[model samples]
Target: MSSIQDLETWEPLLRLVRAAHAEQLAAPGGRFTGQISLGSWTLPAPQPRSAPGRALQVVDMQDQFTAVERVQAALRADGASGVSYVVETGPDGRPLLHVITAGPAVEHGVRSPFVGALLLVEGAVPEPWRRLPEEFPGAAPAPSADPALLERTLRERLPDAIGATAEEIAAAEARLGVTLPDELKALYRVTRARWQDWSGDYAAQERVSTAVGCELFPLDGLYIADARSRPCPWQYAAKDAVVTAPDAAVQGLVGSPGWIAFGDNGGGDRLALDLTPGPGGHAGQVIMIDHERSIGAALRADSLTDMVVNHRHEWRSDVAWNRPPVVVQVSTHSPVGIAAAARPELEVLRIGPTGAPVSLASVAGLPRLRTLTASPGTLADPLEIAGLTDLEYLSLGAEEWRLLLSAGAVPRSLSAVAIDVPGDQHPLPVLDLANELLALWDRPLITRTVLEGDLGTDGKAGGTR
Candidate 1:
């Protein structure tokens, strides 16, 4: 039960809101908001029927009044759609802080900007804004005296905060030689209060990310410092846009775009590489790259094109490199070559239907090859894949000719096979593929079929149900 004074920045304030909301959530009829932002964006209100159960419960607790009757009256008076409530175990008893936000209801009914502002009024001022205590003399300080200023700060700093964190990461990568995972890099970009390293500086690195944007880089992931030109580990979606910057360090000449590089000598795009498992004990056989674009593509090898045949340029910096400029590009370049070059003992290969023909031929001699995923790839090399008798799971893509032909011909030592072949797409029946593949397995395979017109409908089976 820390006072609002305990929280100076919006981060901690948001944290308190979350904690208070969570406490209220633990009680009956308590609810909190999904996101804590200024009442600017046109969000939908919580509906009793539409937002039933947890969905209905999770309202903007920070915005509503504590009294249930007051909250209900406010909602009815304002003609608002929904209000969130937090059940706080006060000295007296379990009291609630009701929250509401501007949405379609406010737009059509009130048509007043003040309505949005009114919802943010606190019973007491938080400590962060004691100087401007009048804002919420009874509750917590709202910090910025100017309501518009507070709103603007959140709008500006939220994205900038995201960018700043990215910069810290890029600078770190530039210091180290490896590009981080898409999930990991995303963890840095999304605005949240959890990024406090032991130093407690708000991961101050984000200051740099906000400065750089589409003009120079994508500003999507963290910039890294690296010595070796390692592969990136970001999974990308196709709708994502990628632009090459003229700056050599960022233009995929020395490193990938949307990423900064810090070489060992601080000269070219090379940086230090950390193959060891990071802070948590979770480590993997990774090919760390130096660019965010490549990181995006590499991690999403199935969805996007790799960095093959793309334009390659010279290093932007004038310094000589102790190590070769690791070629950086999208994820779908020559995967066969990448796999061969990686020569991973345990690799997760992401091939497309186009590269399916030569997939296993390249990784045939990979003594360390362990796990394989033929994601986004139409079909895998049945004969070539069969050779890897130590395989754990073989996730089949839309392509089935290769796997269908192998049928009972597969290795008996294989463990699991996740098939996603739809009936209409396949000339052969799904049952035939399932029956044949099941016969060759030492263990029962997790078989699945995509019925015609029912291509992506099962949520539990990776596709939509």
Candidate 2:
């Protein structure tokens, strides 16, 4: 048996634990192998003695960076934790694997008289076993215990492994006008997990169906459901909480004109009011206060204000585009309810018709924005983003042919671009844009352009819109 005293010593316990973990990892059924081993347990740098009586104050590296760092990163990356151990010095000269039991530290020399009968193979266990805390030293938990129950309990609150509902899938397909990838379909089979708040990984790809509660679902399923851009009718399970996703698909659905109208296709048409900063330094009121209050606040404070104040710098040919455009591709089952779109100097755009595209050009004055987009029928200029050096990821529909031809200077920062064009359009500007974007990023563009119909021609000009 090992004790807390054994753990107090730094070498023996660490060596034994590492060996145990390594053996476990190397087992055929282990999740990780060939990359784990026991290493020296480096203590924290020595500090000046405070009264030379601070219980031999020592730093536990295991606590600070090692514990969370190894486990957290692994979990985040969908991997397993690394193998490691901790050891410390004891009162006796001997070293031991600290096995703390109940409330006492057993010395390394205490071997049971029935040791032969009770001893098990030292390195054959396939699980981690920890000793009791210093309160009860020398006792180690039984090794080789099944970890399934423990892992399950720990992961219970996580998003479901299964995908979204059939209704959600059908809604998104109808809205986006495209089929989802098989990989995504597989992912959809798992349960979807709602983000605690806005802004995170899911924000780019998933949005909660406010119409539906922030139910747990799979990422792929959420994407298929257009969770990122749609406004869900689902009520949140938590009171006064907002459902969030990285993508804006589902958000778009809720905000679509039809949904807003609350008709069979368009129903959710309510206004939200809130206060904002008046032109100079004055304050304004929040209209339709009963609606989403926080969204209104965000619109007034961040989105609208940004559109007005940053328009020139963010999206103007006169300004010599310098910054990177905020390029976003929101595929959702509904339309986005843009709270603010009233600037006048903005440039660069990309628009898809999962829903309505109204007043999109209204944010032209936004100084920090470069490119822009909206539904197929609503584009100020398809190529308007060309002159904005910061513009990237442009999407437009076939109706904006004139806008594409009218583009002046191609944006330099465009490394990737997606355009919706008519079959007869010339490929010259598109090629030029691709070349320019490639030069800026020094990499090939990752693009997805949609044309009115398939342009089967294999030539560069023919393949893309």
Candidate 3:
């Protein structure tokens, strides 16, 4: 029933930062009422701000595009710090500009970075970084709340919180041949202090994870703990030469050797820092590397500080890519039970009788063991895992462990237990084990095993079918 003029399109995409909402966000910081930054001077269905709270009504409908420009200038002059859009319809209607909101201190005349984003570096930043905008226009590193707050967190923000001292941090850097970024160093300090808040075994700490980067070692354990460190999964596989520098080139590729893996994202993914900056990048930008992606992905944040503050915020649009499969992944190269001993930071362990089964004795010592991966027939010593009170994720043969669970040999904290299925789609003879594991559960668990490569032909329950 509408005219052709109203039949074009009407859509509102960007999340609106209502003047009221923006005001509320800035109140905590005692900032000024922010100025509005409209996407364009000429809008299709421009709303009139005739009401006292509305500012858009100042312009007359009869005004041409030039007059709209004047209105925009006036609004900017009024100190608007955000942008919004208008939706309209006409036979020849063209979609207007988009809306975007970025605010914290709106009352303090805080200007947003959206709209043109950044025109030029101008004189705000130093040289080298000045020309970085053109070199890396899409970089959006994280920011810090305040220096004092950061210092407190790094020092002793909480009672009983203790951070890694400068000497210890320096020593770690010497061993790794790299300097820790300020934010990264601060994060390290946080790790040491976590013990005060966390009393349970380290494996349980997985539940307390707040960001994509979990299981990250504090300054103390970075290079000296566990296997010392794992070279970037890229550039070096189980066989290729290790690459460490971000700028290191091989086969016409800029190797990401500078990435230092310090944190685990609970899942198989890893949280790392790209020490080798891109065109506009810095040495300590945060990045998430998906183990399943298999290299070529040197994903990075704008800076280490930015990532710390904006964790899972606007900066992270594609979050899933940063994480690996939820299940455990025992690399084919893990040579039996050695993975559990060598990579204590990892959640997955590949053990089997055929792959030079070293020893499951290490399981008792790993405070963070989550998932054990192997065919049930290959495990030389499932009994050795009896000491892991905080163990959670596990994969095994269907029928192999019915007695293990009934005998109370498994950890009570088990969350998920599953196995791979054969082509026949028949359940492995694990009824007793399943029932026993189910009895130990305080909550729901992943009892059904999935088919995975770690699942051996010997009726092991390692993978998801």
Top candidate by TM-score: 3
For each candidate in the order shown, give its overall lDDT on alpha carbons: 0.31, 0.28, 0.39
True-structure RMSD for candidate 2 = 31.9
The TM-scores, one per candidate, come to: 0.25, 0.21, 0.30
Model 2 scores worst on lDDT over the 10 consecutive residues at: 110-119
Please give, for residues 1-465, the per-residue lDDT of candidate 2 as tens digits: 111122222222233333444443333332111112133222222223444555533353333234334333433343322222212222332221212111111011111110001101222111001111011122222232223432232234234333457676666557545553322232233333334333365542233222111222333232221112333211110001222123211111112111111001112212211112212211211111113321211121112122212221121111111111222333244232332322333233334554444444344335645444455665434454444444433344434533554453445443223334444333334334433434443443222222121111122221112
- Model 1 CA deviation exceeding 4 Å by range: 1-342, 375-381, 397-407, 422-428, 442-465
Give per-model CA RMSD: 24.4, 31.9, 26.2
State the lDDT at 125 in candidate 1: 19
Q: Please report the TM-score between candidate 2 and the true structure.
A: 0.21
* Clash number by candidate, in order: 68, 140, 34
Better of 1 and 3 by lDDT: 3
Point out the worst 10-residue segment of candidate 3 by lDDT. 3-12
TM-score head-to-head 2 vs 3, winner: 3
- The lowest-lDDT stretch of 10 consecutive residues in candidate 1 is 300-309
Q: What value of lDDT does candidate 2 attain over all alpha carbons?
A: 0.28
Residue-level lDDT for 451 in candidate 3: 17
- lDDT of model 2 at residue 85? 22
